[model samples]
Target: MGWLQSLFSPLKKLWFRLHSAPKKRRGIYILYEDVKSCPYEDVHVLWSILVESHTLRTKV
Candidate 1:
């Protein structure tokens, strides 16, 4: 049992390192199928919210 545990210790550390790493953070992406669906008024409201929230990146 001791020998088995010793042999697998390095593998356990590697597994933990691979699994516990932080993933890349992504920002919001809004897509509208119809171009005319989003009106000027609605875009103004969305812009205000994004500004207040400090949105990093937005793809529309």
Candidate 2:
């Protein structure tokens, strides 16, 4: 089980990168709202990236 985790650890970073915000903008950010604790940012980078990507696609 531990070996499996190690093998997939790098994927986490890649996933975050693929889902993170663009390097040129700041209006887009991932917001994480957790009632269990407090509203905070969790995937800001990822959210921004995704939103920008979608916007670009829609424009096409």
Candidate 3:
């Protein structure tokens, strides 16, 4: 069992890396800067507005 687990451990890690969400820290600094500059009082509102604008731009 130990040998089987060891043989598959690298494959499991590869699968996880491919399927997982990206690391948040990668873009957290950018998000912090955007939040600092955003005028909306609620961060959720800002996020929705950004999402809407992005969707609109992509659709056009």
Q: Per-model C-alpha lDDT, please?
A: 0.65, 0.65, 0.78
Ranking by TM-score: 2, 3, 1
Q: Residue by residue across 1-60, what tens digits does model 1's lDDT show?
A: 999999999999999988996865444334322323666777767766765575444333
Clashes of 3: 0
lDDT of candidate 1 at residue 16, scale 0 to 100: 95
Candidate 2 lDDT tens digits, 1-60:
999999999999999999998675344332323222444455555655777897998799
Q: Which stretches of candidate 1 lie over 4 Å from their true place?
A: 23-60
TM-score of 3: 0.36
The number of the candidate with the highest lDDT is 3
* TM-score of candidate 1 relative to the true fold: 0.35
List ranges where model 2 is wrong by over 4 Å. 25-60
- RMSDs, each prediction? 8.1, 13.8, 7.2
Models sorted by lDDT, best on top: 3, 2, 1
Winner by TM-score: 2
| TM-score against native, each model | 0.35, 0.37, 0.36
Q: Give candidate 2's TM-score.
A: 0.37
